[model samples]
Target: MNSSQTEWAEAEFSRGWRLILASAFGVGFGSIGFVTYSIGAFVDPLGREFGWTRTEVQGAIAFGVGLGGFLAPIVGYMIDRHGGRKIALWGLVGVAVGYLMASASQGSLGYFYLAYAAVALLGAGSGPVSWTRAVAGHFHGRRGLALALTLSGTGMAAIFVPPYAVFVVENCGWRVGYMALALLPMVALALAVFFFFPDRSSPGGAAPVHARTLTGFTLREAVSSYRFWLLLASILAMYIGITGIVPNLIPALTDKGFTPTVAASIQSGYGISLIIARLGIGWLLDRFWGPGVAAVTLTSPVVACLILMGEPSYATALLASVLVGASAGAELDLLAYFTARYFGMRNYGRIYGLLYMGVALGAGLGPISFAYLSQISGSYTASFQVALALFAFGGMSILFLGRYPRGDFGHEARPA
Candidate 1:
């Protein structure tokens, strides 16, 4: 109301955007840029060098992901108690070192698995769980957009990192490709964490002006609640259907008579659509009900699944890619936004970390499940039908979440 109050509020708003910007870069480079999207680029190279089966080479990643799921809750607790700034900074450095070690591998499966596991541990804090806490702590009215912008980094990385990894691999071999992937997180995440990441419990941390009193369930309470279980189950179901299907997208398209190049271009379209969908979903969330937006987004994948399974054509394939991308784009932004709205930010990091573990589990196992199904059935038709059913179920499940908790913004003090 007063001049001083107005000025302080404006300043905090500006600072929040800066935090989003830095976090965007941190996650883009740290999470997907180097790790998720880039990993596929190395699989062939690794196989070629070690004379290993595809499954054997991919096993290291699967092992790391499995362990990362277990690590999420711990990472969340640390962020709640210690803050994301220190965790991200140290974690990025560790990732860089881990990449270097990976580059120096002696073709030993044990060594490769160990190196990847270390990377998973150090890099845990660089994911959405770490930064979402900070962003949620800083913004509310505009929180959806802030998270959308932050998660856009993954879409950006998906568009560029694979090709970049291939370039590095072609010129310098897989060893150097691993090392090159290290630079983004080492330099960007480190600088961003130092300059922009906030510590909400600290005195000087930038917080939104209209900051509300925190009001919602604690971690124990959240786990005990039926709503939480429903939310988790919905997420798991959706991912189980979506994850395994997307990676085989190109192959599915090509088998329908499309050329490999055409299928590849449509796949690239999926990445571009992710960026557009994130921005669109973010804008909608600020104006509409959170759960509604999520439910609709989740349902889009059902149509995509159908299109892919139906008559094969360039137009149908492209349409399916965009729909799948929309579903993928909505996932993290919805997860971060809904978690804050439903549970509050008191223990946001830890709570989200636990939920994210569900995400990690789906991501790790979904593709494998689809592959196994196809292996047994001798065609992907059965797999696609199952995925379609899961998507519908997941979408409808969110409708029961009811109204998001509202009232206060700051964490309410709990009795010990």
Candidate 2:
């Protein structure tokens, strides 16, 4: 609140901005960004090529990402034992390999699903679990803003990957599109992360001495807390709602008579709003009640669900997309912020990793479930109705978190 405090926060950014930028790039091109965001662009192509139905095509996500979610706790434990930099670097390489495997998929849908699963399992470290751990370690004063900046990479991926994938799939075929996605993490993100993200646990890595003294609950202690379970339940519901809508958005719009390009453009609106939400909500988290902020931000998407349920104009569709994007944007930010505040950095990687599994599982389920609902009901309306309920439930559930534990640096302890 004081000028000195403000300056200190600013100083944290000055010292750690490279780490933030690296993290952003890693997250954007990593599993959540390239793998998750680009699936929509590939859905129609993959379906047509393999004679797969919508649910079948979307099922790749369920088998791939859902099963991969089981690895989060393991990845988290590794990061806690070692450091994120090495894990992230190797994960990016594995993600590139996964994309190549997807590109090489034959007519076998099982093979395609396995390829995606490989991507999720191999690239697990490249997700928020590793990146946010490093970022959390580096910035305490402006932690919220730092995390927002880091995670806005997903928004960036949302903005670029769909259209890019669509453009590539349209011109060069879907195989080439997957190959193109591979290049992202292989070249640019890998270079950025290797150069900028330092391993604090490694010799000669040059972390602040005080970082070694950071404190928090162990994995067992964190798991025992009621707040941990509450956070997991809320995360699962919120991600299920948003992720179900996102990859399905382009197809749903195209079915409603929008052109593929137009649908992709509308999805861009979602990405733009996501970026806005990350930055704006990040700022708010530092100064406001995080649960209250999450409650309002996540719940606003109910209106988006309502908008999409009816036939709407392009502008309305865009509005709905933006609202959904906004909610998606807030989900990871809240997850990372809440995990650090409630549990502490002692077991941050493992705690956040377990929580990230909820995100991964929800993401995996959302698309397949949405596609299944659409297949049965002949429209996205049923899915939207279900998602609307989920958004409300997830948003409201954050209110039950009560308060942050005392003595967590950078977060004020509220009265119990």
Candidate 3:
């Protein structure tokens, strides 16, 4: 190659870390929101287009959460043991494959469910566990922001994917919408692997020599502990309420007599709120008492539920979206930062993987259970009311976390 070409390639490699960071976000935007939350807006439309039932339509989401739940810890362990880039890249490819499979369902909702769920497992391969691990490895000083920014990709996807999905479905047809979602993951995979991946190393620019997972599980020790369960339950409840209950929101709202457009608009606000809240929370988490801040912020959905139950005021709906969105936005950062502080990092993937199973179970149960509840109760009001109480209890429970360790993290002995 010519000298100029060589220099250009060198410069590109110099910018490799930034590219990797952007790739994390890009893949997130392209994959999760598009494939997961945003799929809701098209739920009703796709059901109509393909002659499917609401239960059948929402089944796809339930399946993905369940799949993610089953797979997350394993994927998390892989992330810690292996690395983030390859797993995430493959995950995106799986997501793309899911989208394509859903598109090819020939109007069968069950086909979408099976396809989307398969993609979801692939997605679990590249989910927050992997991304957060990657970012956590790269920055010690900006760990909070780095984690926040990486996880924020899901919210970014949430922002555009739902409304965008609806638009694609309305204009081009449901098949095209699925295809669009399918195709976008290829871009994420390409950017992630080639231009935007991280090196195996530490923040001081020392190459990361892989750490072994600490062995010997002592359930007796784990059960006796208060904070292990505290952090676990806190993170778990947040995941379920946000991922499981919230994604079904627009559909729930529409079932309550709101127009499809209005539902889509509310969903969009939910998406936008996450993007705004994530950056804001990232800034605040560094300065504020994260748990206190979390306590206050986590109550959004309870407040949102109260707002939602009133006479369908657009303002109230907007507030609900904002609260839910903000909670979802900052949640992973809260858990990751807090976990690293309390438990230490050597077993980060292993510890987090186990913790994430709570998330899986909660998330797995929340949607499917809510769908059945929706059927029995004949409205989302009661189900959301129950979720609201859970959010409130969880929000208030943050005060109890005062006894655990806090402050910025540095190198420490791994938890046994």
Candidate 4:
């Protein structure tokens, strides 16, 4: 980049660093981070307590996240029209309440599912959709890096939440552990977002001097494009593979004869690799072909799937987790970067919301599918095989996107 371009990119962070920090915190504690990552730690505990099958235990995710996916587009439209601040703040509050409701469940599977659904419904705004929109509104030149930094919050959660959840469940019981998890969003995320996130559309909030003019395809135009459908399918497949594997990694490890603590410790490698991958992919996206970068980074997880097919040692298990984390790291960064590059920010929230619906559904379906398959086959081998194919298909699909359109900020082009 030219010196002028470098300075302009630097200035985005100089002025909007608070926005990035707040977004990262919000995302780390939001439904995707706290709920999605921590649910696995609870699976065995919940089953033991309630005498539920693995499928029954994991079914809550399917119900809750599926409902959340259904609501994502609506929430996106609201974010576009109103701004993300209010929605995110309210959503955080609701997420806290939902966790408390879940803690109160007394062995009723229906009640457990309802509580989780409430968490997803009420916490939708606290997810990546709102925060990424806010960040996208402000940063253009450094959009890829900014998004990677923001999304690294999930990596942070991945690093800390599983082991933390396991510790809490071991000492305080699963109910108290759920209650403790509520504190993350209720306190840290809500406070950071309330104080630091500057939504230009909000009352009295100021836009950055370098904020790009809002431009991009409308939701209708985006949906009609072949690229949009391709991206949606790619996201769906990738998440199915990722979510299916990561959440079950701990249980799978324990099944392979590791203790819960050891399993969680090994999973920490996944989180560390995720954080590194996000930053690395972000840097690469700004400098290379975005689709090519995505293809290479996301397709590496086939190795992880293969590694887990055997009773590997702890060191081998850690390697497998790292590979999985690397792929997980690429997902949201690619999603946000592609949406901005291909669709533009004109209808970003709505468009991204629709795409995020794929993530939500895939996340919801992945765990349940893994559990169901494992239950039927008495092993995770079938699930891993399925995920391997998904990783290959999803990773390669991006190559078909061809080149980005010629335009100022991706606003002036549309697919035929």
Look at candidate 3 and give me any clashing residue pairs. Answer: 19-196, 20-196, 200-208, 201-208
lDDT of 4 by residue, 158-245 (tens): 9999899999999999999999889888765556756877666543243432343577798889999999999999999999998898
lDDT by residue for model 2 (41-110), tens: 8888888888888888888887657766778889888887777677777888878988899999999988
> Listing every candidate in turn, what is its Cα RMSD in Å to the true structure after a full C-alpha superposition?
4.6, 3.0, 6.7, 3.3
Q: Candidate 2 vs. truth: CA RMSD? A: 3.0
Go through the candidates in order and give each one's C-alpha lDDT: 0.72, 0.85, 0.66, 0.85
Indicate whether candidate 1 or candidate 4 has the larger TM-score. Answer: 4
Q: After the best TM-score superposition of candidate 2, give how far the Cα of residue 37 lies from its true spot, in angstroms.
A: 1.3
Q: Candidate 2 overall Cα lDDT vs. reference?
A: 0.85
- Clashing residue pairs in candidate 4 (N, C-alpha, C atoms within 3 angstroms): none
True-structure lDDT of candidate 1: 0.72
| Alpha-carbon runs more than 4 Å astray in model 1 | 1-12, 32-34, 190-213, 249-265, 310-315, 376-382, 409-416
- Per-residue lDDT of 373 in model 3: 74
TM-score of 3: 0.85
Whole-model lDDT, model 3? 0.66
Give the Å error, residue 380, model 1: 4.4
CA shift at 403, candidate 1, in angstroms? 1.7
Stretch of 10 with least lDDT, candidate 2: 201-210
Winner on lDDT between 1 and 4 is: 4
Please report, as a residue range, the 10-residue window in candidate 1 with the lowest summed lDDT.
407-416
Worst 10 residues of 4 by lDDT: 203-212
Q: What tens-digit string does per-residue lDDT give for candidate 3 at 146-238? A: 567766776767776677777888788888888887766776666665655544452322133165333222434434558668877776676
